[model samples]
Target: MQRRTRQQLRISLLIVAIAAGLGAVFGLAIAGAGDGDGETRAYARAALRGVWTGGLIAGLLTAWEYIYVNRPAGLWVRRLTFLGNVGVRSLIYLAAIMLSIWSGATVFSIEGADPFGWNAQTVIQVGFSVLFSIGVNFAMAINGLLGQAVFLNFLTGRYHRPVVENRVLLFADLVGSTAIAERIGDLGFHGFLNDVYRDLSAPVIELGGVIHKYVGDEMIVSWPDTAAGRSRALQCGIEFHALLAAAEARYKNTHGAAPALRIGIHAGPVVIGEMGDVRQEIVFLGDAMNTASRLVDMCRTLGRPLLVSEALRDAEPSEDGPALEPMGETGVRGKTRPVAVYAPAP
Candidate 1:
């Protein structure tokens, strides 16, 4: 989890630095009226100071979310302690950062001390800073770590026109979801599935997988095929199993049932682009996505918790490579060619 936090911290720092730098440039440009270049120089110094001060605060806030709010384990752990950690962390950050900022302003005239700043202006600015920190972090928490990558592409129109990309996809479905739902009732099932999604995210993100989408009880994760191979997507599935197994006692106590996960992996080309007029979104469309889903469905029929296609599976550096057993080629719903399936060796 510390490693996960460190990975997320890099993204947080990048987002905050860009935001603060842009804010500085625009703020200075607008205020560059009187004193000519002297005022510009002042703002430049302020901008650099602001970068360190604001960036440090942002880093702390991101780590707080990882330790107490954003992570799956954090969510449940906080739940047990009545979310006391959430309240405690929130207050500590608020007091500590504001005091630090106020001190930096008074002693060092940090950020040029926000010339002509009023109490209301300071309050509003701090409010916006808080909102920006929460928004960016949660966006990454809800979306994938590559959220900025996708959004940056959308902004640059890099994906405005469709482009073919080779990606490895892993589709996972919660086995016996219907039966579990029936026993737990709709309301209870909602919470159970929420837990499942939250739990699944840690392994996927930690392993460098980006979530493509979540469809009802199914989750689709993607990565560049080359990166996927290097990251060992196969181990991710096995890791998920080990994770759930380790949490079995907790799952039973909290949800009153233990759930099984079935996952399938495949790799090929997909059309990636930004879509929609009113609100833009990144979309992936191609047989690769569908084939991954179908292979996941095959998990139930084939009686394996994990499966991979020949295209995605590979011989590792280990003496025995990956622990994969052949499931042979099978017909897929949307493709002319049958996909070769392999299950992990038990």
Candidate 2:
């Protein structure tokens, strides 16, 4: 929640800065149009001031939306159904829009000088401005910072040229998903999985992991080749299961049982490229990913909740968290040489 809060604030500020630049350009053009009052030049020079006058007001209103979205759900918050919550969400948007209009009017009074008088005309103009601002904020809320970056890059074929990156992959799957699904009907089981996945996002985000994809009951999280990512790789996996343990009560209460995570961590080079013809998407391709997936599967047989490859085990770790115990060699399917695995000390 904290990491997401930081991300949301950065994105909000970025969008507001862009909006201010645009407002300044328009203000300058309008100022240049006529032989203006001495104050026109003052306003022109301090365009950012006027823009910020609007931004600070708009930020306070919209920041709440980001908070609620990224918030950790309590038992009561989780219990609210879609219909039960839409009205609340609608009210938030409405309040945000109204506040933005008032701010826009305030911005028109730059440096204690007001050329535009408050009236229905002013209300209508400010209403339009705030509407656009709110719309942009809502879009950001929906797509998230990572999604927006990917979508923007896709337009320019940014990853068209395949590049190899040293990335650590964590393949975490729910243990006994089949049994869980059987206990809960398909529809109920679908909701259960959704809840579990949402829970997983907290630790991943907090630890700087990117959500690669969720394959049914399994979720794939990855990190770049940076030292921060490499060192915290295993710790993130450990903290993820810790998070599940912490949420066990909520899960049990909601579904009559709690699911646990079995994570497999591996590090290696992967070719990052764009894929798909009809609906394009970024793809991370490598045998390292396959090995990571296999390691997680091995967890079911080994009866360990967490497993790590020799590669990840040997890597210089940043945090003095859990110690990895040598688990001996195991024959990995599709590979000739047996791979060494380790389990985190309890």
Among residues 3 or more apart in sequence or in different chains, the pairs in candidate 2 whose N, CA or C atoms overlap within 3 Å are: none
**lDDT of candidates 1 onward, in order:** 0.69, 0.72
How many collisions per candidate? 0, 0
Each model's RMSD to truth, in Å? 5.6, 4.3
Off by over 4 Å in 2: 1-23, 39-49, 73-101, 104-131, 134-149, 314-320
**Tens-digit lDDT track of model 1 for 11-110:** 8878678756764563454346324445756666555545555655665666666655665555643443323443445465675457545643554352
Reference-based lDDT, residue 137, model 2: 50
Shift of residue 47 alpha carbon in model 2, Å: 2.0
Tens-digit lDDT string for candidate 2 (1-346): 4655678778888867766676566556544543566565555654654465446545664566555555654334334554444444555656655555456545554443344447644465466655755565544433443452565566567788888989999999988889988998788889889888877777777777888877888888898866678656787788788888998999889987798988999888999888888977788898888889999989988989989998876554435676778899998888889889988877
Model 2: lDDT equals 0.72
- Candidate with the greatest lDDT versus the true structure: 2
- Residue 124 lDDT in candidate 2: 54
lDDT of 2 at 257: 73
